[model samples]
Target: MKILLVDDEESLLRTVQLGWPEPDDEIVTARSFEEAKRSLLPGRAGDFDCIILDLQLPDASGTTILSEVRKRTDTPVIMLSAWGDTQFRADTLMSGADDYIMKPVGIRELHARTLKAALLHRKRSSPKPSVIAIGNCEFHVQAQLLKGETHTTKLTGAEASLLEELALANGEPVLRTDLYLKVFQREAQFGDKSLETYVSRLRRLLNEHTEDGAAAIRTIRGVGYRLVA
Candidate 1:
């Protein structure tokens, strides 16, 4: 898998380079934000599996880079920083980081987490059909864009898949287990509240285009959900 490593520290960069799995692994290291942007310019977002980012950089903050990355693609991100405070963790997660790690990290653990996060991101980001319609709402899969009535906006990869699965089932109440399996293609993992979170986020995304109606996605207690469009 292709990876982008961003850190200002040359020593840590060398360590990461030596720690990676295969000699053929496509890994790019950038010591500054400017270089990172240059690396991105030559390819599309899906060209990289994951990005290992340091929170502190010479030109920009990690959050700034992360926000910009989110704007471009849904590539999984693992924040590598010396700051391990609760607030920092919360802030990064809210800003769209997949995972957080403190600096002076073990290469093995970083490799493992990197693989796991990249796999998850890849699962969710695979392109499907375009413009799935449920009730009145429309989901544009290729563009990761959504539209209903007069409004239109983009959705994250996971959010689009979760909504698409429920929407395909029409208004039927899908079981939580089934929904998880169908959407994520695996049993629940620790803190994989991402499914439920995507449901809520997708609901909000739907609401932007909906008018004068209760939200299209209804959470059935003890069950998964139903799309009312």
Candidate 2:
């Protein structure tokens, strides 16, 4: 576990560097908002497992950094503030903070929360169906990236939902009606174009890596469709 520390207090930073849970890559320290951005960059999909960020920073507000981090990665974040304001706590959680800690916080509490955050992150980052392989393409359901051997495409929210339904079918034909009901959370009616449109989009996305082109999704005519290998 690599942890990024974004605090301006030199005394606390030094103590945390020497005393925190032993991260695999050592404690990464950032004293300002710009420095924190520098440490998190090049792969915003989390260079670290968890981040300990101070709500107060010299250059920019921690909320700005938090919003930016969420836009790019699923990394768990724990916001640190000197004040234990109720409104501040509510706002931070709404703005994508995973956990919150007030100053004069115990080291034990910090360790425990970090561990909790890590476990939660791991669970949420992976789908139950997990990695689904269809022929030569691999669909990372939770990550929302459909990967080919030499190419890749990102899945939209609707596309991922449809793919998850098809994956759960285990290559058996999943009815169009089932898809409509499961994905849209409503009863299917005739002439609903939503299901078919997403199916068409997924078919094209999967066909991007194949010799028997357009072969990953099988259309069973009057039945429905199945994910094929």
Q: Pick by lDDT: which candidate is best?
A: 2
Give residue 131's error in model 1 in angstroms: 17
lDDT by residue for model 1 over 95-188, one digit each (tens)? 7888889977998899988987786566556664567774466777668778778777887766777777776564677678557665675555
Evaluated at residue 133, the lDDT of candidate 1 is: 71
Q: Which pairs clash in model 2? A: none
| Strongest candidate by TM-score | 1
Task: Tell me the tens digit of each residue's lDDT in model 2 across 1-229.
Answer: 6788899999889877666665544578899987887777758538788998998898988899998888878799999998856666766776788778989777667877887678657754765766877877788888999888898888888898888877766677877755765577554556778877888888888778655536777888987888875
User: Which regions of candidate 1 fall more than 4 Å away from where they truly are?
Assistant: 127-229
How does candidate 2 fare on TM-score? Answer: 0.55
Please give the lDDT score at residue 99 for candidate 1: 80
lDDT of 1: 0.77
Instruction: Note the Cα lDDT for every prediction shown.
Output: 0.77, 0.78
